[model samples]
Every structure is written in C-alpha cells, then in structure tokens.
Target: MSDWKVTHSPSAGRRPRALSPLREHLRDTFWFAPATAMVGVFLVWAVASEIDTRIVEALQDRGDYDAVEELLKVADDARTVVTTVSSAMMTFIGVVFSISLVAVQMASGQFSPRVVRIFVRSRITKATFAVFLATFLLTLLVLTAYDSDPDPRLVTSVPLVQSLVTLVMVALSLLLFVMYVNTTLRLMRVGHVIDRIVGEAFGAVALLPVGASAEGHALGPETDWIAHEGRAGVLRDVNIARLVRVARQHDVVLRLIPRTGDFVVPGTPVLAVHGGRVPPYRALRYSVSVGVERTFHQDLGFGLRQLSDIALRALSPAVNDPTTAVQALDRIVQFLAALAPRPLDASLHRDRRGAVRLVQPVPGWAALVDLGFAEIRGCAVGHPQVTRRLLAGLDDLALLVPEERREPLLRHRALLAQAVERGVPEASDRTFALRPDRQGIG
Candidate 1:
C-alpha cells in the first residue's frame, strides 16, 4: 500500500463536484455590486447639487445674502455627511472582501501563508484608499455648496434627501461586492481540492487482476457481472475512500468494519493500492477495495483448525510429521463444507473426480451458498480454496514496523502459503496446488 496523507472534502458519484471553479468566477466578478453603486451615487449627487444651486439663486434676488449663505452652509454639511458615510461603508466592504478570499484559499488546502497574506492585502488596501478619497472629495463639495441666507432656509429639503440616497447607494455597492466575491471564492476553493484527491485515488486501483487472472475463462467477473450480479465474492475490494466520504457527507461515520476485527489473508489480494495523480497537482484520491468474496469463504476456513492441519501434516494418510506452522491453508473441500454456518446447514460433497458433487440446501445455509457463488467463478479446475489470510492471525492490522523491517511481513506470508501446501493430500494432482508467485506478498 502507498503512504497517504489525509484531507477533508465532499465527493459526488465518487468524485467531487465542480463547485469551486464556479464560485471563484462568481466572487471575483462581484455579480454587479460596486459598479452599480458608483453609477447611482454620481447621478444622485449631481441632481442634488443642481437643486441647491437654483434655490440659492432665487434667495439672492430677495437681497438676503446672510440667509443665502446660511442655506449654503447647511447644503455643504449634508454633502459632508453623505461623503463620510459612504467612505466608511466602502472601507468596511473592502476589508471583508479581502478577508473572504483567505477563507477560500484555506479551503483549497494549498498555498503558503505568505501568499495568502499578499492576496488579502492587495484587495482590501486598495478598496480602503479609494473609498476614503472619494468620500473626502464629496464632503468638500457639499461644504462649499452651503451659505447663510436670510429669506430662505439654508438648504432645500430635496438636496438632503438626495445626499442620503447617494450615500446609501455607494455604501450598499461596497457591501454587495464583498459578499459576492467572498462567498464564491470559498465554495470554489474547497470543491476543487476535494475533486483532485478523489480522482487520483480511483484511477490507481483499476489495475489489479481480480487477485489472480482477470483475463481468460474467468474474465475476472468481467465488467458485465459487476453491473448485473450482486457483488458477493471470494473477496471484495472495499472502496474505503467512498465509504469515508459517504460517512462525512451524511455527518455520520458509521463503523461498518471495525479497525481491528476485519480479516485479510494470503493469496487474497487484500487491498488495492492507490497512488499517482492525473496532473499538475499530484494529490490522488484512490479507492482501496477490500476483499468481499473472501470474507465468507474465510469463515468456512475457520473451522478447519485441527482436522485440516492434521490432514495436511500426515505424510501419507496415517502419519503426522509437520508441526503447527501450516495454519494458513485448509483442503479446499473441507474448507468449503465447514462454512455451512447454520447448525443444521447442509454439507457440500465431492464426486469421484474431486469436482463439487452436490450442494444440498441445508437449513439456513443460504449465506454460505451465496458466498460460494461469489467466489466459485474464480476457481480453476483443481484448487478451490486459496486465500491470503492477514499475517495478524488472518486479520488485517498494521503492525508498526520500522521502515527497514518490511521484509518480515513478506517472508511470513510466503512461509504461511508453503506450510499449507505441505499437508495437501493431492498436492501433486490438484490443479492450483501450486502457489502464486509474488515478490513481496507477505
């Protein structure tokens, strides 16, 4: 198995959805926020200025310079208020706009802290300066427009309403821009990261040959069988990534297989290794399918403890010589028959040719038969029950080993296989009596 680093993500149909790319595009564009505000604010400010000027001119005709001046001063104050409010709003919006991008970057699970800092600074700092400058200029314009006038109020009510509208619009624009950009950025970043991991993992596991030969008469459960037949097997390759992803998506990590209880055996392709990526990012998300077919067949192998070993060790039919080392294997028929799990389950019989003679339905033995059906297709003419039991007493457990001591695991798996063959009654005549050859299977 390849070494893997874990990351979090949601997947769809065994792949992550195209969520990030879409979010990235939408946020950067701001979805028509700040631009619209700029236009609306400018229009309203111009209209308000014109209205105030006309009022001031009318008052000048009444010989009321003092009153005119007072009205102008009020007009100027109103403009200042609009400018200041808009400025603050813009600054707040800019800060949030950049802050949101960081959240998106973090979700991607990529990029260094320095790069993220740069990203945040450019967007927010620029936003703050632009908003403040625009607001100050607008305030100056309003203050200049006001003056004291005796005959009329300092500023017309219309100009006040106009300034308020302009300020609100500008403020709203900044807010909208930040919201749109930030939200989309977050979604897009996480989605892309998740998809990359899943894709890489699946592409790697499709290479194994159904344990032995996926080709020839066996056709290794040819694609069609996987499609139509329910997947019972001599062994199953559980897609662990899919399982974990499903648990996460539902927020319920169901422990279907206990970490310590699951079994893995020799000759059994226990795990499909996952590795390599399809592109610029080498992070791969692969599926390691554990053996489904082998599970029940192995249950059958369990009962053969003393009797089967005793049978294998007998040099002829009557003499026992070998020690207890050959525990990994059992005679194919004895192993299969013992799996009639239910107390009253029927027994499997072999004919003169050593072919399966009969499968009489025993009481409550459907599960055993189903398990047999799943695995029997992989059987050759002679050897019916070859298995790769985990070195952990036929259970899969990662015994912590130093990097240098990986050889012990391999040596043990090979020795277990050899030990089983020594006791086979028809080792010379059995079709698959010969063990499979792999460099480091143990």
Candidate 2:
C-alpha cells in the first residue's frame, strides 16, 4: 500500500554486480561529498602554498620591486578576505542547510517520504554542500599560512596563490548557494517531483533485462532455500552477475526469493537454489544488498509506487486536492504508456555454457497496471476530475499497449465506470466522469 513497501514471497532482485551497501550508503548520505571536499581542499591549499613560495622567490631573485610590492599588497588583502570568508562560511553553511532541511521536510510532507531520496541523490545538493565546505576549509588553511610579522623581510613569502584559490572557492560557494535554493524550490512543486520520479523510472526500465516468461517455468525444483543473515531491511538490489557466476560455479540456478523492493528479514529465505551443489552462504549473502528503505537503484516498480503515493495523498480527506491528484495521474499515465510496449516478464541469466544460472521474476503487465491504477480508482470514487483522469489514462494506455496487455486496461476502465455510476448519484455527472478527457475535464 505504501510506496515500495509491498513484500512478495518470491520475485526478482536486480542490478549490476558492482553496487554494494557501501556504495549505496555513499549515495544516500551527505557526508561523502563534504568529506571528499575537505580532503581535496587541504591538498589544493598545500600545492598552492608551495607554488606561492616558488612564485615569490622567482620574483625577488629578479629584483622586481614593483611586482614584489604588488604581491605583498595582494597577500595582505587576501589574508583579510580569507579571514572574513572563513568566519562567514560557518554561518552560511548553518543558515543555508537549515533552510534547506526545512524546505525538504515541507516537500516530503506535501508529497511522499520516498521523495526525500530524490533530494538526497541530487547532484546539486551534493555539489552545494561540497563547495561550501571546501570554501570554508580552504580559507582556514589559507589563514594558517599568513605570516604574523608585518615586516616584509620577516614575512618570508606571501601566500598569494593560496589566497586567490580561497577567494575562488568562496565565489564558487556563493554561486552554488543560488543554485541550491533554486533546486530546493523546484523540488517543492508537485509537477517537478512527478517528472523526476518518471525520469528515474525510465532509467530503471532501461537497465532491466527484457525476455520471455517461459524461462521462469524452465527452472527445476528448488533443492534448498538459503536463509538471509545479518540485519533486516528492504532488499534494494542484487549483484546479478555475481549470483549467476556463483550459481554457474555450483552448477545450480539461483532465484531471488523476494523482489528488489521487498522488505526482507533476517533468517528469511533470500534465495532459492535449483538443483545443484549448494554455493557458499557467504557468497550468496555478499551478492545481496539491503537497506532500511527501498531505492530506485533497481526497483522498477518504485516509481509507480511513488507516483501512486502522491495521488493517494492528494485524494486523502486531509488534503482533498483533486487537481494535485490529477497531476500525479498525468505522470502515472505517461509512465505506463511508455512501459506498455516493453516486455514485462521474468528474465533468465545464463552462463557461458548456455545453462540458466539465475532466474529473475519481473512484475507482470497486469500487476504493474494494477499498481498504477487500482488504488487511485478506489479513492477517486467521489472526485469527478480524478475519475475522469483515470478513465482518460486508461484510454491512453489501451491505445499504446498491445492487445494481449489490453485486458487489464479494459477491466480497469470498466471498474472505473462502475465506481463512478455508484459514487455519483447524478446521471449527468456520471456521464461526464465516464467520458475520457486526458486533462481530466478539458
């Protein structure tokens, strides 16, 4: 019912073998960017300080009094600028991130909690944080290089290059601040959020392996079910290549016991080994990645789940916003129309020997159709705009999808008609609601 929290007894886990919990951790957290930035800032300051020393020595050896005096004056101004930048940066970080968090919270509340991950994975947000911290740290390093003595003879060499670099970092941080605020504002808009979710869905669909369902039936009886170990959470993704390679090595087929977005508990059977020597438990566990919440990394249905959540929230009595629900439905229609033509069946991973090593169960067309519309239709009973949009969405999908996949679409269309007939007492309203309008009315 909630976004990506549905648990299926046995379904596919997918993605490349290179991804792991650590990688996911870095992607989902804010620390990695800032930490990397700090380290980079230190290295840049060290190199720049060395270069400044070299530049100053070269100028003095040439006895260029004019250039040396100019450099000293620039160095003095740089020190003052660096001190001011360093002092203001901490406050800037606090104020900027504080406002950002509040805005993010408001957006999450207005949309769905799953939306938070989008902001977390946002390149702008990460870059903003990285630049801000880099500017602050670079300034600090530059301040440390300033000589205490005002005398030019005792000053040794001025940190001309370091100061310039620090100033550049400050300018970059300010520029990113503007961009960060703009991105945060866009995140709050429902239309923008839906578009982003749809974009992620398309990206996920591109990575999914398309094939016939016959392979799912070709697998032999399961010899053993491998129990999950360690902490409990949602099965975010699996290292499919590794699983296939391991299965091939053991002369068996490994089928994931749960889908990528399904919540998995410790001691649960995470994999089903079909007819061969059992592979090592450690290898199996290592290939599976779990997290506290579902991610778009591999979960194809997660996008639909998020869109559905937004629609559901909009239709709720607390919000009672039909226009928002219609917007959400607009995206839902777009997503399904794009997905309707794709092969929605289980895919088989085979070894070099032409034997099936892994079987991944993808969601059937009917299931996806149901996930996208069934709940919205039920909640849309009283709202004519949403009801009309549902009808229009179903009509759009009916035209785009192949005949074999149109049965569910037709069935949903009938269900919507029936719901409108019962929910709307007026004959005219029922007729209007049943009429297909892509914009829900106009």
Candidate 3:
C-alpha cells in the first residue's frame, strides 16, 4: 500500500503545466484545426487517388492483373495522407474557433480584456468541434467507399446530404449577416439623432421630460459616448415650452396650438403636457439610420465623417447631390441635441407674473442665420440657440473647405454680418432671450 501511494503521490506532485491563454483558446477549436488540415491532406490524397485509379483502370484494360497486384502496396500511402489532412484541419479549426469566441465574448460585455475571459468559450465554439468530427467521419467514409465496389445507394445518399447541408449553412450565414447590418444601422441612427439634438440643434430638448435618444451616449464611435453606454443629458436650457417646441419641431405634434382668436385675454393656460409626449423624438432619432448608404432624407449625424463614404456610395452612385445632403443637415442638428445638458425648469416655473423679460440686447447676427435656415427649410426656427451654434460651427469650419466653396457658404455669413451692421428687430441682443411675459403679441 505504501509503495502504491508513493508512486501516485509522485505523479500528483508533477502536475501538468497550465495551458497558455492562446493554447486554451485553441484547445476546443479542434474542429477548425482539423478542417484546415484536412483540406491540404485531402488535396494530396485526391491527386494520388486519381493517379492510382487511372493506372489501375489502364492496366486492367490492358489485362495486366499481375501489375495491379504488384502495385497494391501503394494503397497503404492513403492512410498517411488522410492522417496528415485531419491533423492540419484540426489545427486550423482550433485557431479560428479560439479567436472568434474570444472576440465575440469580449464584445458581449464591458469590453475589458480580463472580465471578458469568463464568457470567452461559447456554444458555437464547442459546436465547431462537432463539425470537425463530422468532417473527419465523412472523410473516412469517403476513403472507405473509394476502395469498395461502387454502390449506387451510397453514392446517391452521401452527396445528397452534403449538398443539403451546404445549402442550409449558406442560407443561415446570409440571414445573420443581414440582421447584423440592420441592427448596426439602427444604432447609428440613434447616435446621430442624439448628437444632432444635443450637439448641434439644441431643439432636440425643447419638449421634454422624455429627451433625445440616449443611445448616442453609448455606442456611436471611438470617443463615442455611445460605445461606453454613458448617460448624459441630450439637451441644454431645456424648459417645458422649449421642450414642446423641440418636440413639435421634430414632428411631435400634440395639436395644442391656439385656433383663430379662441377667446384668449391674458394668462390663458394653452398647453398641457405629460411625460408620454417626449420619448418619440428620441425613438425616432434611434430608429433613423441607413447601412452604407446616404438617403435623400439623410442626417448630419455624429459619425458622419467616418460614414460619409459609405453613405455617399450608397446614395449618389452617380453624382454629388444635395437632396441626400440636406438629410444629413437635419441629422447633425439632432445628434448635437442628444448631448445637450438638461436644464432645470426653474425658469419656466419661476414667478414671472410680471417679471418675464427680454434676454438682453446684443447684435443677433446668429439670429439672421437661423432665420435664413428657417426660410430655406420652411420650418419656424424653433430655438434661436440651435441656429446660433450651427452658424458658429459653420464659421469655424469654413476655413477647412476650398476657396471656391467658402465664398458661397460665406455669403450667408456676409448677409448676417450686414444685418448686424444695420439693424433687424429680432437681431437685437435683448430680443434673443425674450421672456414669455414680455412678449408683445401675448
């Protein structure tokens, strides 16, 4: 008993070395390795088998049975070919299975190199081994059949099954590819909507308790808050009425506007809002995306620079067109709005019974741009701040373009500058932040 125990203890003490991460990743990828190895081995085997068949058939036709018998020893070489083929295929399969599993698992979670390891091995990786085993069995069956007398039954069944399986897998892969593309597009649209609403337009927030699509804060791009799934307000200076205007501007129609002289003296509570009214814009923002294509109703989204090529290729296949470009303009407005910080509605609820007053007196050159945009788009410039910021961005980026394009773009700037030099009532600094109570019409 002591001798037996001593031998077992010695073996236990010399435990096997732990596998490296790479080895472990490839450990269950036995199928990929085998599949790859088999391809090469099978190629050699096929060539040899063809030569053997030709020689044997020719010799038989020539009535040389004795030569066929003499050359029979060559058949043993088939084993070497098959074995090498299987080993090579197993090795290749292991590598791909390991890599694919690790990548997908890493993508599924927080994207850390460490925590991702826990879920690294998945059902697909394990299933790959089964596929490899099936392939090996099929190879063995084929080799066995080649040596045996041809049976019409085996011939019809094996090839039919192989064709069916190939067809099924091809169909499945195509379906998955389409689904992945669609989902990615949807997420992109969400990011753009949020960015336009928060980053550029600022009107994305005019309506709500509900706000711009928070999706942009998560998965948009590299520095993309969307990828990290961070939560930030998608609006700034967002009061309830501004929120309403923001909503209405984006087609969040509640039908609460006044009709012709609906008997209003002063202080008539016109609109009543609930939380339900706000999420539509956010939803719409998240839902509006295209895959590798720009649309006539395009968006000036967060990741447009990266996506422009795919979009333009998809949209204009022939010529550069502004019809698709205008959609991008709206998208830009929405994406920026998604990042705007939410303001406390303190101003809205403030006791302005008589205190509602004008914002301040400053030359509203920015307002002039907003007005021009409003004229071109045929939408009331919902919020002046959004238009102001857009103009500022245009002015800042003007130098990036060629001298020729700059002149045309700057013509609007020139017009605004002229307005500032002269005087428009809306262009007054005081009128920019006009208080509700101070409205001349109301």
Candidate 4:
C-alpha cells in the first residue's frame, strides 16, 4: 500500500505563496495593458504631429504649398476629418462595450459564471478595445494641433498623414468589432465552451513534471504540519520549483496537504514538513497562493468544476436542458480518456540529485471520476436523455481506460443504474434507460 498521505495540523502557522497585491490586482484587470498602450499611442501621435508641422513650415518657405495646392487643401480639411472620426470611434466603442457586456451577462446566466473570465481575457476582445481607444486618443492629440488662429503662410498643416492613419485605424476597429461579436457568440455555445474547458484542462495536465511519483515517499517521524494563516480561499497555485529548492536546502520532504482547487480556512493544515528541522515558516508560506476563486493556471480540477457547474445548471428545474448536460458529459469523457493513461498518482518532486524534495497531493483517477460524474449523475434522476448519455459516455470511457482505471467507471455505472431504478419507475422506462445511447434512446 502507498504510505503517501496528507497530514493536517491546525496550530502550525504557514501561508501560501502569492503575487504581490499590486501584481495580482493588475492581473485581474484586463484593461491595464490596453489603457497603457492607448497612452503610448497618444504620445506617439503628438510627437509625430510636431515633426509634421516643422516639415510643412519648411515646405511653405520653399513655396511647395503652391506647387501642390490639392495637398494643401487636404491638410486644411484634416482637422475636421480627424475630429469627426474620433467622435464617431468614441461612440462606436461605447456601443461595442455595451453589447459585449450584455453578451457576457447572458453567457454567465446561461452557462457557468466562471466563463465570464474567458470572455474578459480574450485577446480579440482586448485588442478591439485597444484599437478603438488608441484611435480616439490619436485623433484627440492631432486635434490639439489644429490651431484656430494661424498665420496663413504657416496654417498649421492639418497633419493630413496622421489624420489618414486615424481613418485607417477606424476601419480596422470596425472589422475587429465584427470579429469580437462572432467570438462572443461562439463562446456562448455549449460545444465551444466545453471544448475550451477540455483543452485547457489537458494543457494544465501537460505542465506536470514527467515521470514524477506519488507512491514511494514515506513520511518521517519528525514531520511537522504547517497550518494556513490567512482568510479562507481555494488553493490556486504553488511555486513548486521554489518549494523543491527550499526542501532540498533544508533536507526535508514537504507534503502539500491540499490539491490546487481545495479550499483552506485559517488554521487548516496547508503543508507537512518531514525532516529533523522545519524550514522557515515564511519561506514555505510564500510558496503557495490562495485566491477567493479557482483559476486555470495550475488547478486542473477547476476546469472539471466549471464543466460540472454547466451540467448541474442544465439539470436544474428552471433550465431543464438535458441536451446541454449531455453535451458537457461528452467532453468530460474526452478529458478523462486523455488523463487515464497519465501517472496521476505521481506527486513526488525531486531535486537535481534525485532526492525527493516535495510531495503534493493530486487528484487520482477515482477523485477525477467522482468530480466529473458524481454530482451530475445524482442530479440527472428522471432525465432519460441525460442518464442515457452519461451511461454511454461511461461505456466510451471504459473502452479507452486501462483495466485498472475502469473499476471506478464500472462502480459509478452500477450506482447510476440504481439511481435510475429509483428515480425512473416504469419497468419499460428502466429497460430503455439502461441502454447506452448518446442521444438517450435506442
């Protein structure tokens, strides 16, 4: 049997590693980067306008304005064109923002609220906002150069080139607005959302260190439990490399008590140090990060949780959308199929010398199976479509999963049958329910 286990100690003070408050704040606010870029755009336009003014003055001194009278007229009209474009872009941005917000709200209410983060973090959405804001700022800067009172000989050349550039930017922003709307609409779809969640969950799985083991490490008698010392929140991420380094230096094995998405309250055991002397409490504490909600950064379970939320919501009496639940189950099967062959029991981390330094708990095959299917199955009761699809999904997983990992699927299948037997009363209905069909019928 594996001696690996998580030890909890409530009295030992420890904190989880986290970014500085400012850095974390900035990360949550997606507008910061685009806002900074807009300022840069404004400054660049202002400087370029000054240079254009000097060039125009020199050209007039050389009597170039008379030689290119058409170009002179275009420059004279540049301010009006820029002002009009800037005002129009400002109005367009407001409309786009309003529409985007409504889409986000609808997605949140229809799907899972957690998906709103996906919309907010979308690069296309951010880029659209940045381009529109930059165009507005650029035009405003150029407008400042349009002097009402100017010497006729040096009529502050309207920065015609800059105004034309602003027009080009306006066109680009319009195209992006269309693309953004399309992307937002796609995000609202059940299939797209499930695919995205599955993709990201697999991506997180890929980040795990290859060939790491979770079963061999044995706890020493001198192990000291380190308790959490902050407000309650989900464990989001841990600086594993740093924890490994600290463990190596202290010649100890640090066992992280909670998986990434596990919630921890004050005085809960966060880590267990197995060595003669515990490493500095602060060092261990600073290596783990806790947040109010789970993020996809290193928390693979979070994606599963989000998918489950979507299915649960679909199963709700108010929604009564079994097809959506069935859709979520299909993706869950895919995620688990991909994960079944991986070394999920492996949590041991070693330093360069091959000595175990850190031992963190990860969800094993059984836990993931439960996370993926248990709640949704319980709620799936009389919904023949959802129950049939789930059994079908389990059957699909059983074919893909190794013999050792198939036990949980089989066990869950038995339980699902029992639940269906109880919730769905008619014998003929029960017989049809047991049939594995993706569409919930023979």
TM-score of 1: 0.26
Error of 3 at 302 (Å): 9.8
Give per-residue CA lDDT, model 3, range 1-442, as digits (tens): 0110000111111222223223433532345554654464455445544555566667677776666554443333444555454456556556654665655453333111222222222333334444454445444644453443233222211122222232343344345435544433332342332232233223222322233121111111111001111122221111223333343343332212221112333334323222223333343232111122211111112133322322232234343333333343344333323323322111121111211110101112233223224332222133333234335534543544434335544665454444433443454642551212211122
Candidate 4 has which clashing residue pairs, if any? 15-285, 16-288, 17-286, 17-288, 214-346
The residue-by-residue lDDT of candidate 4 on 216-322, one tens digit each, is 44666545778888789988777866787788888888888888888999999988777657888777656778888877766767788889999999999999998
lDDT string, candidate 2, 1-442, tens digits: 1111111112234333454545765888878998998998899888998998787778777777578777788888777878888899899899888988998899888889999999998989999999888898888788888766665544567898898888788788888889988988888899899999998788667755443222334575668778888689998888777887788788887887788888888899888888776798777767888888888776788999999999999999988989989999998888877777566655566665566677666677899899999999999988888888888888888888878889999999988888888889999988877877778766
Q: Which residues of candidate 3, in runs, are more than 4 Å off?
A: 1-52, 87-95, 107-138, 146-397, 402-442
> RMSD in angstroms, all models?
24.0, 4.7, 25.3, 5.2
lDDT tens per residue, model 1, 1-442: 2222221111212332224323322333432333543454466567877875676666766767776666545656775666666457556646765666567566323322222322332334335434444454454455444433433544443355455545654674566456556644543442332222222222321211112111111101111101112222322223333433433433322222211113444333222112211111111122222333221111222222222322233222233222211221222222323322223222222222322211112222333222322232122122223332222322221133223333433454455445445544576533243434221123
Q: C-alpha displacement of 266 in model 3, angstroms? A: 45
TM-score to native of every candidate shown? 0.26, 0.91, 0.24, 0.85
- Point to the candidate with the largest TM-score: 2
Between candidates 3 and 4, the one scoring higher on lDDT is 4
2 or 3: which has the higher lDDT? Answer: 2
The TM-score between candidate 4 and the true structure equals: 0.85
Comparing 2 with 3 on TM-score, the higher-scoring candidate is 2
For model 2, what is the C-alpha lDDT against the true structure? Answer: 0.80
